[model samples]
Target: MSLLDEVKNELAAITDDSSLAKQAQVSTMLRFGGGIQLVKNVPVVFAKLTNRSSAAWLKSSIMEIWGYDVELRKASSTLATGETMEYDLVAVTREGKRLALQCGLLDQRSHEITGIAPAHIQGNIAQVKAAWRGAFLAKGRLSDPGKSSMMEIVCPSVDSVNDLIMAARRLGVTAKPHRVNSSVRVRITDPDVIERMLILMGAHTTAREWSGKRVEGETRGKANRLANFDDANMRRSAKAAVEASQKVRHAFEVLGEDIPENLRAAGQLRLDHGDASLEELGRLADPPITKDAIAGRIRRLLQLATKVEKQRAANAEKN
Candidate 1:
């Protein structure tokens, strides 16, 4: 199963500590996952849940906590879902109105409450967490931690987009809103935030596994970078060695026996060990020296050769 399915299963299995929290969860789920309507002048609240467990949980929560009977039905697959049918939980009762009031979906006078509702359905942290859990169970999806660390949710409305952002903020994780066509999306890209949110939603085991996956990904990335860096360094060293051999040969042609004894020895060592590193070349010298000391002698030898070559060019021009 997908990581999202795991989280949803875990969320659907959660047990609420209070009826108020359950009510908040139910209200949020109904608002985001389905529609609240008046069918034949009677209040009807329904949710379309992708996960079977989530659908069962919503239906049972309404029945057991709110004392409302919900009919769970199989919904036809849409083209957008690629023929994956979902479950529908339809609850028709006056209690739907009460749940809407608590969630600020409707006012005391039975009017629709538009825009983002005031945060925290019951002004309690548990209510906020449960409400967020409900929204996630309804619409949230997470990418595999081994591939990418991101969570995205389709909000029912612009109001819900902000509601989700506020809810996430209350939990100390930042969620950004994005608009794609007519739908609003809440995106959480930070791996830390995704892990923390999963934990807050009561998916502790999934969160831990996700954390391990993230760390493994980072470690693998770092090792690849180090290996690439070493490859680049080796390429540079090989190029430098070839270039030094050419310059040392040029010195022998231009400055010949005129080269200083110490400098000539350095140039000869470079010519003999065409593929050796500066440290190895230093050790191969008759009088062993440091890499830096041998390198200095070679630099002087090349400079002397360049000076003579420049003078020879000037003499040829004059002649």
Candidate 2:
């Protein structure tokens, strides 16, 4: 079975064992699979396994696989806001390097209904950020000699990486971006980086998810409204409306001063046919004017018209 399958099987076995839960809130052990392994209990669940799970399992497993001594500690505290928080597992590698892992699962069904998949991912990132900050502040007590400490965020989906980066930015932290397989990942080596990555990621992910759902809903609504109209009539009405506006603007420019031949032709077409667009104007011209060229000429003409109107107003004021 795959690593994911193994994790699921182990989680099922552990959850079913009431003895394991009573002995320790969390458990850590090594299991042999495709290779030697270390498995730690991760409690957060969304719809899918997240970065926290990967980090928790990978860190512990790798340490054992490499024959490094590992220690797991439980840390919990209440924030100034009176919010209670807990750390699932804090592992110290034999090299004395400290690593913190937070795991969460996002349910696909809820994501589909609430359309907050991104927000859910951001929440996971927030927990990781909190754990990192908590660790850094306690570094005086947590740090060990000859060991550099770092935090790793693991999520099942790569979609959350951008959110994590946003969180780092908000906290004024410099976060290093990395990848864990196909998933998007960010690494925090600095305390400030950890703070910022978490905040930015959380905020951005929330905003992006909200915006995406809003846009999709708006688009669908618009399509429904337009569905009632006859396509040919809508197209004609749209074309006519555009041509009428363009013709008036073009006429003002033509009356102002010397106009180029190509521009003159375009203006005439707009004035004569109330349904012609820039594309149609382009097709009619000799050595046809490109759509961009037509647009540029129109813009310049409007600017000139504005200047002429301004001059006329100034002259009238003087009189």
Candidate 3:
């Protein structure tokens, strides 16, 4: 099944369950698979599963099933000397790599806060610092000479992601936001750890939905062409050319006069010579003019024809 389907199935399983139990299940799953390490002396289960916890659980469950080792950990320290903070989840891979996952649930009460709220801002900073500490510490302890560890922060909403990036700079952690799939999956490499944690906490639910296929080549190609073409300009040019042609014809009709010397000569030359361009018309004229000059004259004549047609329409309306 697809990642989305799996998430749907899991969500359905939890929908009927108690909120407290669901939170514990999610937190435990994140911990067991070594996906996240609980902060020193910090409590794992919060008082109740708020909307944030629900979102966290759903997102974590999808990641767990998708083969990523996910975790939910807290942060131990902060820039404020005595202040300590915790993150919703700290997912890590089997290779000891880590990703900081933060869930921002929109409050139904306040439509103003659609995604990440300003309240969770400080906690996100602490998470970044924790990830950097984990990455470097893991690198230092690595017995092998090659392959240094790295960490990333994953935020569900665009606002949270942007905020975390700025926060990471202040904390001196080189962190980037993890891009989640449309089904709201924050990918990690350690699914087993996350899964085991979930199972231990009784949050192990099956997934129901799947991700959709990407756009096909033919559709993509057409889109690319349209994106590059200057449609507005082409339409304008075509309209101008047509208008010019009509104006020249109208002048001849209105005056009941023979075609102008220039136009008659040009037409004769066109008939005599097959497939001649505007440049050839300019060359054939007594007073040589640029191709652009000839085109301008033609355009004016067409415009005159258009005016005449409009006049004819108005006259019919009056009658």
Off by over 4 Å in 1: 37-44, 66-104, 114-120, 146-149, 172-183
Which candidate number would show the highest TM-score if scored against the true structure?
Answer: 1
lDDT of 1 at 288: 93
Off by over 4 Å in 2: 1-250, 253-257
Q: Where is model 1 poorest over a 10-residue stretch in terms of lDDT?
A: 113-122
Query: Tens digit of lDDT per residue, candidate 3, span 188-250?
Result: 223333233223222345210010111233356568778768676667656754554454445
lDDT of 2 at 8: 28
The sequence of per-residue lDDT tens digits that candidate 2 reaches over residues 171-227 is 556656677556444566653333243233233332233344445666776786687
lDDT of 1 by residue, 222-312 (tens): 8999999999999999899999999899889998678789999999999888889999988998879999999999999998989999999
User: When superposed on Cα atoms, how far off is each prediction in RMSD?
Assistant: 3.7, 18.8, 17.6
Residue-level lDDT for 123 in candidate 3? 45
Candidate 2: clashing residue pairs, number: 26
lDDT of 1: 0.81
